[model samples]
Target: MGQPPLEAEIEIAATPDEVWAAISNVAAMKKRSPELVVMRTFGKPKVGRRSVNINRRKGFAWPTTARITRWKPPTNDGGNGSFAFYVWPTDVEWSYDLEPSSTGTRVVERRTALPDPSLSVRLTAKWALGGADNHDTELLAGMNATLAALKVEVEQP
Candidate 1:
């Protein structure tokens, strides 16, 4: 069995479009996400676009490739939107959902539950990533931090 899905949510004092601008810009995400060290995308980001990313924890770093699977911008009337990407090596999907909230926008960052991870991924998680469970716990914390940073960025004057 694979790890369970993980999520974190934060309300930002900005419109859904503003939030979407921040989340959709993969380059800026490297600054907000604690684990993301580098993000290089090929061509404009949209459904089917691909990116290469470098993530780090402690002193260990790893490379991951992902393809954009979902890219729905917020409606002009401040409706809901979401962005998602399917990652290789781990066979997981990461997404950000934006919904209009009373204050502004509710942003939810999530990692899909991995029901079946490859043998290589499992071994790498055990040997290099301090086991799947521990890394997942850290990933949850990172998600929280990432959202907090995004909130600050979007709300800044």
Candidate 2:
């Protein structure tokens, strides 16, 4: 069987635009992610924008370059929208989608459409990052933590 997609979702007490603001800011992720140490973007979030994601675990830090592939702000009519980027080396796209809901706004984050890794990269992931299964577990856990932290931050007065 194929590997599972890494995903998580959360309902926030804010509007879609509010949630969008929080998630669109690359620098703000340091506050929302327990594993992310820093994210530096070369330009504002837009299609083709480039950024580097730096993550740490047990004192080991690694960086990955990414390019934005999709950037749709929340519509005024409360329609579905998404922000997404493709990370290099792994070639997986990470997306954050926004939608209106009864409670407030539903925010979904996912890592999907991962390209098959080359043998060397696969070995690196196994040794340094973790095996595929363990990495997916970590990604899912990180998504949940990120959404939960953003919910708390956005809900605060």
Candidate 3:
């Protein structure tokens, strides 16, 4: 079977628009994401927009580029929305989804399953990232941490 998608979710005591505000802001996301050190977007964020990202793991750092594939901000105060990007090198898509909930909003972060990573990506994962499985485990944990941090930030007064 193929690898399962990496996912993590959290409920925040804030509206969907409020959550979208945080999720859509690439600058703010850099602060929330554990692996993301820098994310520079060209102009405003929209579908088809491009970004340069620098990710770090301990002493290892790598540069990657991505294109925004989806950008649907909440249409109304309590509407659902999603944002996604297609990342190069790994050929994976990462996304964030927001849904209105009873208490406030439910935020979900997801990374597409990587069943056939490129040879270069495979080697880099093995050498620099402590193997694919281990790195995926860390990525799941990072997703959880990122969602938890976002919850804290969005729920703040």
* Each prediction's number of clashing residue pairs: 0, 0, 0
User: Over the stretch 45-108, how does candidate 3's per-residue lDDT look in tens digits?
Assistant: 9999999999999999999999999999887433899999999988889999999899999889
Q: Which RMSD does model 1 reach against the true structure?
A: 1.2
Candidate 1 residue pairs in clash (backbone atoms < 3 Å): none
lDDT of 2 by residue, 16-90 (tens): 988888888878989888778988989778999999888776656788889999999887445667899898777
Residue 128 lDDT in model 1?
A: 85
Off by over 4 Å in 3: 76-78
Whole-model lDDT, model 2: 0.83
In order of lDDT, best first, we have 1, 3, 2
Best by lDDT: 1
Candidate 3 yields a Cα-based lDDT of 0.90
